[model samples]
Target chain A: MALRDEVQVGSKDPSGFGVHRKRFVYFALIGLFVVQSGLTYTTSTEVPDSAATLSEQARHGEALYREFNCTACHQFYGLGGYMGPDLTNVISAEGKGPAYAKVFILYGTGRMPAMGVSEEQADALVAFLGAVSATGTYPVRNMDLTVWGTYREMHTDEK
Target chain B: MKSEWTAAKGFVVAGLIALLSGALFGVIGSWQHVIPGVVDAIPFVKSRPLHVSLVIAWIFLTAVGGVYHYLPKIVGAPLHSTRLAWLHLAIFIGTGIAVVVSYFMGRFGGREYWEFPPVLGIPIVASWLLLIYNFFRTANKHKGPWPAYLWMWGTGIVFFLITYTEANLYLFPHFTGNMVRELTVQWKAYGALTGSWNLLVYGTAMVVMERSTGNTAIARSKTAFLLFGLGFTNLLFGWAHHIYPVPSALWIRVLAYGVSMTEWIILARMIRQWRGTLEEGKRGQGSMTGRFLFASEAWVFINLGLALLISIPAINLFTHGTHITVAHAMGSTIGINTTILFASVFFISSAPITKNLRVGFWLFNGSLLVFWLCLVGAGMVKGYYTVLSDLPFQSIMLRARPFIVGFAVSGVGLFIGLWMLTWAGVRTLLRTPGDPAELDIHSAFLVEGPGSPAPENGHAVRQGSTTTLQP
Candidate 1:
């Protein structure tokens, strides 16, 4: 791939302005990097006590599980939706933790379509579910359910 | 002109298909709001997919047709095979229609944008492979220094293929672990596709400008090259904002911002330099099409400003994933790509098409201006209300109904303009007598000159007679 050749290359006139501009951009980028890095580090380090016990892979998986709104249909403990099977003790039922969880997610059941969950998300979800199953604790409440109920109440009262 | 009937037929047929699909969706989308709760009905879901998919298909087909028409001229070679072009066109159009149908039939993967399930994706992939074979074979057969525009397009095609493969993740079914990473990949693929399309558009513009103006300076070529490089780098790394909440390394964010800014700078430079080299006689006087073309330069700046605004960490935190980003997308795509395409079409169809299309041109530019204003203004209000003031998104959307209506109204103008363009293209194909003198010298010079026409009275003169008054 002549990717480099695609650039409009010109002979640099030995001028300090171009060099100065480059330096300026580099410095600005570095400064932004340091600030963002600090922020990320602080955010990641301040995990809750329950989450602190979870492995990094498990934590990552939990994050995905939350992001994808997987709990919208499937019940995790008494939390989440009632549309799908309760996954509270799925790890115990399935025998293997990550491997079985990965399969279920990749090739979903009859009603549930494949969610295009990547392997990384699958593994992380497995780790998170395994951690949950092993510990028997639902770390976070499903906020969407409460939000929906609150919206319903507001509408009902208005009517 | 090498009258490649097969390629021409492919282009015309694809365009006709696109027009039909766009009109159909346009009507559906217009009525979607009229039926109140009916818009959210299950049937509407099928229609929504059809609308979005058709838009994508039409844009892609038009872009590909433009590429086929422009590439050979830029590289100084006949097309590898008109037959292959037809085959590629057939596969693309056929698969596109099938996918849209399947989407309505509920045989979709249900992913936004990548909704066409594996069955549909396979044929599209095959079509791309066929295109790649044809393009590369043609490139290999030519024995000369390839133009920077062609180089940019070639690189874009290669990356497009790679990005598509990665996005499909068919090889690694278990590759879902990192949510941030996967989202990044999706955004990267989107950016790559859009960026490559941008490069191709700009590259075509460069070729057309060069041919019309009769100037081929190494400086101009270098500028084109720089723009393409910057665009590529920007696309590869500029998707960091999409993963703002994800645990990404700091360098990725830095790279994203840096590369994105570089792209803006390079494009800005190209526009400036091009304008600096515009001469008088080369482009005759009073060219509204040229004026509109020049006005589009302002949009580049507008896009640059928006890019800078969103690049800031504080603003990005609030604006990320909001309608403001949508505004930016519309601004760039509609503002930049559509404007440039209009200019090129006008230039190409000038002599063989309608005479005195000045009214159409102005109307088109006016409608676009209104369209963009409504979208951007409404987007800002929605963003501020929802993100900063803690207003409900739906409430803000309700408040912005007028603007949305304005957008729809503007779409009418766009529709009219597109019709005019289709008419002009047909007339050109038919070799009808258009006012050759109707071509403005200023626009001609800008095309023939080393650079684009200088900003005259804060407006650029437009080239060509058949200016569609569409936004």
Candidate 2:
């Protein structure tokens, strides 16, 4: 076969003459933009409503905490594993707000390894954890955090 | 003839390595269950790396050998650099040995498939670069716009380098942050190296098929090229499934699915076309390599099914980051790539076989059949219990013990096949009766009835009295 014919058969012309190729590229770009915007919007808006009493930043922080599998280790309100200390009264003990918790997470102390979570993720985790600390009810459903909520409730009642 | 010699040496080395490793893996795999708590031993972890590395080494050596033999014939020229080829051989063997040593010492970089520490990794990378440089430089001096087979091989080499670079990033000082992205990249790299390299081998197969059959129709070549291109695209983009749990946008997921589906479509089309082309008598030929090649095509579909199953958004939600993915990977690599590599070896070795060659053919095919069934069956059982059940990881490991045993059992068949191939390759190197000229003449006579004047394009062009076939 001729080289020109071979090229034509193998690849769609890049000159935007082909209607299907042009459409595909346009659609892909549009779809990418939409997904990026949607994720950003969901991250920003969905936080405050789920835990309405908490600050907007705190709500976003909560979303990050859930997404990153934090609860797999540290306990909160009798939830999570015993691998790390309970953060139920962490804010009160630190004598500060969510910022102290964020700092601790950012630069982990003693046996706690720094998880290398991004700054944004750290802030969101702090806000969410702070909200949980304030309410004393682990924000389980909002993040789909998969904590044994029933077990936590039983332990909380016992306490 | 020189190309044939090089291929023979490669076959011997690769075959020996494969047989030894297969035996070791089989023994270790069987013992892991029989001996209590042996799975937890440091040696077990070390052995896994050794198994994977040896498999990689054997396949690569075979691929290089096949390419060296076939490229010269395909391009109508002798090899550009026999010295560079020897260098390639040395680098592979030396680095492979270093990797095995490093693994046993617990100095591995600790990544699936990329376990070889940087000490060995650097040399391997250098060897690959040298190969790419040599191949491309030689290819540039040739006349034709790159043939599909050459393109495939070239692309495989280039992508192998890219994959290695991405893999090595994990060893870098600043390798912290974006765990999901890093993991995705790692899997993508693995997929490309294996998938693209498989395509390259398949391309080589296409060339051999054309040479063997004297059927270089544009349609068949185009179909092969398209399948390879589409397969490459799918293999690279389909890695998005690995990062499903990460905070990546949905577009990534969509891209992964779209590309992967396209890959399957092209492959399906190619297999359909190849099946359609198979003549009646050709189908029953006792060429062990031919049967294995046909079986490998079947495996391509099997791999496609597993790929699509895991690619499904709903299924992937559960299967992602699970042992099922590992099964899929093994199925594709061992089931598809290694099978094709062996087929290529069989094709090359056909040039010089003196004995019936059919014995080797049957042994190899039978071994592969056993290997495929045992591995697939074992993988399915392991995937189901490990992924679906809420059992502890250790309990799941216990459930997988039998499958591990199955793999070991299957390795026996693979060892037999490797030995047969080595024997056949050695015979070919010795200018045995079944070499290229003899097979070509026999096939030509089959094509054009006895007493008919052999056409110029027919296999008679290479016929010489000295090339004997003792039957």
Candidate 3:
């Protein structure tokens, strides 16, 4: 095929600045995505003991979590549903612990229907949550803002 | 048209089927939220994934199908290999069947959007490779400078495979063993995956617009590519906004917040051009595509505004994990993407503006608006009570019940409207012959060439007159 007869990229612009600029922007953005992904992976801090090998019981509770779709109402790290409160630090938070979570799961609350999970399942669920709580906190409410637009807790051990 | 184009049509049919099935499950899932014991056969757990997966399938299948159908036409060549396209379709349909079966059998292991067994992901990756090979081979033939839509499609196709693979990385223990890394990687993949597909869908919208208006300058203009660049950039870095509440590094959240705010450029552009677009819509009253393009513009305004508001860390404090988040998702997926795809489907099928379709269009949009508002209502109640008052989850939900009921009821209307549109699309796809003359599909609706007279309505219509197409 004779190439000159065809519309080449930037053909619409006699100056060709638009085409060059766009290509520059596109490649630059792709590079940014790669860099961000790398930084996120390398710098991310896991919950304490979150990387520890999971116990068999905790694994069972994990399965129960998905099977019942607890995520439909509850969130971890503030990512799931809004109907329920975040469970990220619930097990470790003041005035709430595994025992507090267990009662609601096994017997249900006034508003939340009983999940009908067995007693053993409830224990496993609490164990799974305990493991998650060991990972991190939620709501990121400590608004220690830096000049660079980040919370102080994100970079420091202020919490 | 080549027989290869028929394969593209097959994907549309498959996508529509998935759309209806997904909507059915969506309705079931919503009602289940209200009446818990209503559908015991398939509980909310099963129904939610089925809804999410199938709808996601519809977007991919149709957007990719549009790419397949248009790529050769735009490139002025036949597809590199028809057999490969069919192979891609076959593999995808096979994978879909397996996914549904797995869901029904209560087998799930992957992350949120991809709740099916992890093993099924293999075929998906393989099928995508076939598409990549076929796409580049054909698209490379275009002689002129590649248009914005071409770049959009290329970026979308290549990045979808990349991000999708990234999403499944959790199957590796290294990623899964750490909660922070796991959550970060999961959402990283999801946000990009969504952006990749949006590029594809938005590319289709651009092509449809260029062809309809016969405006070569539109796609080649500096502003268009600039917008594409901005969108691409946001896709790369803005995803972390979805996870600000996660105790990830501060840099990720800061970078995403900046990236997300850039969308105001697009919103401003839309506002600047609003008058011209409204005039265009008035002139295009006779064209369903014109109407749809206008509708998409309005949705982009509303959705982008909401998106920008929620992207802020301060506002996100209340909105994260709330129904407001769902509202944002719905606004983008249904309000924006669905309308754009509908326009493309009508353009390709040459379906007419009939009374029934008009009713369906109004019903879908009207119901969706209400549905969106009800979600915002529910989220406001929940976000306030949960954040400020420390109410129990059930207590907040109890207060939000009326809105929830409204959402569920309106969902039924949305489904019915979508069904009517889908049925009409199916008929058009089945009946329309492969017209080789229609290879230059983009220009089919152009009414602005030299010596071309506008219709008596003083507007450009589709290539074939209204009388040529069935209502």
Chain A TM-score, each candidate: 0.50, 0.47, 0.69
Instruction: List DockQ for all candidates.
Output: 0.05, 0.04, 0.32
- Residue-by-residue lDDT tens digits, candidate 3, A48-118: 44343456677668768876768766789768755457787778877889899999899976445686799
Q: Indicate the residue-level lDDT of B263 in model 1.
A: 53
Interface RMSD of 3: 6.9
Q: What are the runs in model 1 whose C-alpha is more than 4 Å off?
A: A1-159, B1-5, B16-20, B23-44, B141-143, B218-220, B246-249, B267-295, B346-357, B430-471
Residue B377 CA displacement from its true place in model 2, Å:
5.2
TM-score of each: 0.66, 0.66, 0.89
lDDT of each: 0.52, 0.52, 0.76
Q: Give, for candidate 3 chain A, the lowest lDDT window spanning 10 residues.
A: A1-10
Candidate 1 chain B least-lDDT 10 residues: B462-471
Pairs with backbone N, CA or C atoms under 3 Å apart (clashes), candidate 2? A58-A127, A61-A124, A61-A125, B288-B361, B351-B435, B351-B436, B352-B435, B353-B434, B354-B433
Residue range B327-349, candidate 1, lDDT tens digits: 57657765776666555555544
User: In terms of docking quality, how is candidate 2 classified?
Assistant: incorrect
